[model samples]
Target: MKQVHLAAILCLGFIPYSLTACHAQNKTSQELNKSPEAANSTSETVTTPSSTQIQQAYKVNNIAEFNEPWAITPLKDGRLLVTERKGRLYLFDPETKKKTEIKGTPKVAYGGQGGLGDVALHPDFANTPWIYLSYAEQGQGGYGAVVIRGKLDLKQSTPQLTQIEKIWTQVPKFSSGQGHYGHRIVFGPDGKLWISSGERQQFDPAQDMKSNAGKIIRLNDDGSIPADNPFMNQGEIAQQVWSLGHRNPLGMAFDPKGQLWVIEMGPKGGDELNKIIKAKNYGYPLVSNGDHYDGKPIPDHSTRPEFEAPVLDWTPVISPSDLNFYTGKMFPQWQNKAIATGLSSKAIIIIDTMQQPAKEVQRLDMKARIRGAVQAQDGGIWVIEDGPQARLLKFTAL
Candidate 1:
């Protein structure tokens, strides 16, 4: 097994992950009042500033429009393949502002946070044009998240999907309204697909090896487990199990050095950014930086030295949704920095990496719930907003 060393460099002063139970506390009507700025309103106001006023040296340019876009991936041909939560995939040409919806996607359960999720092109897409997708499917018990693969038929004006096949499905198919199906997919350097599964708020299932509910699963392109998978020999352990003990992991990506990193949401506090390792357990229900909403105490990561700890974590909850590492030339200063979008904190957090572990350097408060951020082929940064009337925006140095 390959090992990556992680060391704590910059301490943000201890922000305890444990919090007092707010369950019995009366739900104040004021708590229902949404912040005017965070409220979802459809207004086409072009707020542009003098180029010189841009301090971070980047400007946001609205590139295209979509209906609740969840993820975007840049193709080798410079076009972007964007996925909408309505079980539709579209091809967006930034140069021409042309958008065409691809047909032939599997049926998706689109409602209350469950729908078409992440879409990633295969690493060898230039030759294969194979695209991978994660979405909520109505199954035996209820709705569960599923990962599938299909070929993109780009020869037509409106591209379509062909050869569609379901690769993996979360077991037990139980639905709990808003399932935390943390469906982010990425193709690793080894050509295996790494998927982050949310615990569906079931808690105990996160530690279950037989169930695939809350685990980081590694699978071949065709959705089969690699024979050499760490738990392949264990009968009860799912062959797809790469690591266990995860809650709602929304952010996942690889650095230039080939290390896999993941960010997951903690209870009330204790949102974590972890460096993923093979078969290493990340303390969840047993040990966490945060306590249960019912005020039950959970052990801290320190309590179990055997389980791996997050390299960095955020108190008060950043609600990190997506992760990307800057490898482009536009922001030379941000080279190798891990860029994460904060959904609750409404910021784009940049973590600077040294020789060992990475540390948070700056948290740029966009004042918008950033759902996804990716480095464009041209070195610019592209970000997608989280709800209805979401705009696909591009950021370039001013």
Candidate 2:
């Protein structure tokens, strides 16, 4: 074990925020408040400042390393089930520093943005041992995100998944593009399975409720449509649409207040953090705080009043991936706050959730492309870096 020291304080009103009702007291980045057009209405120009020195506020231990590790689901028995982008699952024991490959996993397409993704245990896992997995499954047209549930047996000599059943798959159609598989599957407080299905870089589909692409789908644990789903009886569109108009959502988690938050990748700039609401349209291709990769300007969110604007928009895109709410005792100051990792930023952003819409307060540079982050059973923050040699890194207060 190593001891690391980070200089942290419970600073209030840290930086100026763009989210409505948030007031930024100081300029944290070069472009903040630089846009004359962005100063009006529900949106404001907020940018992250350069990385600051932490010297090491926490010690880091490489618990386990895997090839392109995607998500970390901490097991109750001091073990972890980690998914690799190559369609494999492993039982990792941090105490033993050993990793054992699970016997079965769905055969993923194993390419750009396709493969194994998020994994989560059923809330009643102690009794049922049901495990849910999201991945890029081969569909008829093209690859689309799919979710499945199975019984996980780790006590046996050979840990494996059995009695597996298909729970849900993206609706309407699949896509030819390999990237933008918005496949974060999480169970909220209501026991409903909420899923994020990306647009696969397809623009118009996000705005079309008839197409399931670029929408969040909610379902019962058994993959059946809930009786009270927002779109339950509105024809084909009633099949599964929970919230519409998203581009490439990668992270989703519930805050202590029971609010579900999502972080998504945008085009050239304008990565977003949004508070999700049932039946709300998020305005993807129609409006964006960012422009197209070709340098073409897309209308900003202020142009549309009906769509739910992002609580925060990253002008210099962060490529955010995983989200974890801090509830551990290790970071008392961060209890119930939102912590997120990003690929392009190579940092973990700490946001203050005490506001109407969450506000970014601090950016801790992790010095790597962080893929997944979760709070461990022991109150430690566990994160996996992105790469063939991706490592499960643990962060604990000194």
Candidate 3:
């Protein structure tokens, strides 16, 4: 297997408000206007470069470096909490150049693609000090993705997690392979929690109504099931399901218009960018633009009109890791663009979503396997790269 450092925060302590317990998801990514579909698509094709060469934009500033960092989350006070794959969470201040290891972080599997994953702040962090985390855990299945909720107390010289509790986990637990533990967690437009549960390389479960694997789920902050979920009529597994049929989904965020979008790693050449709809099936193993590793062909989305297809996809593959929509004043011209990191392509992808069938306006060559992307509180784009000694970089106007 190849070695990589994959990529975390919501710390804007604003006015405390009570959520009526009904719902939540506002994550910013690039903006795009959809108007047309061709071939097997339901809409018009987003422009593909006639020339396969990538265009570079923006210079990178090496803010700091760490060992295999997985996520980069920002607090309102401009402090960053970064998680490493080997089970360490560090609170970093880009301004102060300080790094403090956060205690009480859960132990991670650290095998293949498994390990400590995403960390996000509660949507209402001002009132509630809850912090959400997703990581690979040892259980009935050889290893499974797990989501846990906790409160991080940073009052003292040391920071640590308190009131920790499990929010979600992969059912039937064991996976034969540890390469696909997709545990990206994002809050939707509603107040509910949305989790990307990978298929665990177990193809059939992506379409299984009885399993949480390969499904996008909705949950209350306290780990309770939401009442209005689409699959609530079914058994336990289906009750929390919001959408089904996915591979290893990592990048999940809602655009300004409240539309949920996710980027999934497809087998071979079919990496996909999808607009997530409630209860929709995003044909994974059954249908994809890419095929099996052995070169076996899977039917395209056109073969199944019942399935939802990708808004855009990569043929040569970029190995997309994290997602961020630029809405800050620091990079004014980059506003409304979905900025994502490409591991294989060694570039930063900037998608122009405002145009009909969003275009890949820029691909900044970073010369490293970029793993995570986030817009920091200081209005700079922060990213973490792959491997030990990986650098946390800040990108601004050249």
Candidate 4:
């Protein structure tokens, strides 16, 4: 077991609407985009105000560290399941500051944003103890994202996966650069599994109904498509699509109203926060608030009346990694607020999603690139940092 070191702690009153400039070099070492200079610019800053007056204090505690951790989900018991980018899963105990590696993980295409991604427990986890995972895998053509679920066999000392079965696989794997395999998974309120499939940095596939890439998919727990899906009659591939034309949707969450919202990184500046509607087309590649990496300008969403527009978009780019609505009673002030972890910005930007145009109310300045966050069973938040030797932090109301 490795020793857990406590880092500098932060305890502060909730402040309103302030953000530091993100790092100019937005891409990571293993990021598909080699030219870090071509990422987003760090010049502009936008501050949005909050309507709430109640201020709550919270403290941050450095829990544990992992190698390039991607996503984390809380177990019923006070433990957590975390996924590392390079094909590893961990069962972490926050109290003991100890971690146990889980076995039976699939081989991933590990590089440049392709690897083991999101981890989610089935809604009926207590009775079934099933776990869902999303990762990138290679085939004849290239690598694509896929979803798998297996029962967690905890009877033994070491946790292991049993009855492993792949549920969904992206269509038409491309040999293009290995990036944008957005495989975030969450079970909706209706008990349907929802997944975000990135377009593999391919422009046209976002609009191509023949491919499942660059789309939101809805399916049953057994990997079967829902009969009432919008494109059920369109074709085999289109039948799984719940929404289309997404660029690199990494973060997704359902509000208390059961409405889904997504956060995606833009090419240069325009990071987006969109309210996802069923069967709607969010114009990507064709229309964006930002331009191409090479300075090629794409039309703004306003130009396209047919396509759906984001409720709010960021010009300077937060490079959001994950989204979760704070429902825990610990942070009463943040109830129902959306917490978006940032990569380039290195902050946790909290937004009031219930507003007409979602407004960012608070920005917790974490010096490290934040990856994934989930509410703890005790109404706290567990956040994982990015890259090797990153820290796992926990926040609780003070």
The lDDT leader among the candidates is 4
**Two-way lDDT contest, 2 vs 3, winner:** 2
lDDT of 4 by residue, 343-362 (tens): 87667877788876677766
- What are the candidates' C-alpha RMSDs? 7.9, 10.4, 12.7, 8.2
lDDT (C-alpha) at residue 115 in model 1? 88
Candidate 1: tens digits of C-alpha lDDT, residues 121-184: 8888868888999998887888778998999878788678898998888876775655678889
Q: Tens digits of per-residue lDDT for model 2 on 1-398?
A: 11111223222121234112222122111111111111112212233333231122455565566788889999888789899888889888888888888877888877777789999889899888999999987778877888999998778878889989988777645656777788898989999888888987778888877777899888889988888888867766557888989999999999987889899987777788988998899999988887776768888888888889988877656678888798889767567888888776666778776776556767765446678789989888888888677767787775
lDDT of 3 by residue, 59-138 (tens): 45667888877898998998998988889888998888999998998988887788899998899987888899899988
TM-score of each: 0.86, 0.85, 0.85, 0.88
The order by descending lDDT is 4, 2, 1, 3
Best by TM-score: 4
Candidate 4: clashing residue pairs, number? 0
Clashes of each: 0, 4, 33, 0
- Note the residue pairs that clash in candidate 2: 5-56, 5-57, 6-57, 16-24
Pairwise TM-score winner, candidates 3 and 4: 4
Window of ten residues with lowest summed lDDT in model 4:
1-10
In model 4, state the lDDT of residue 18.
44
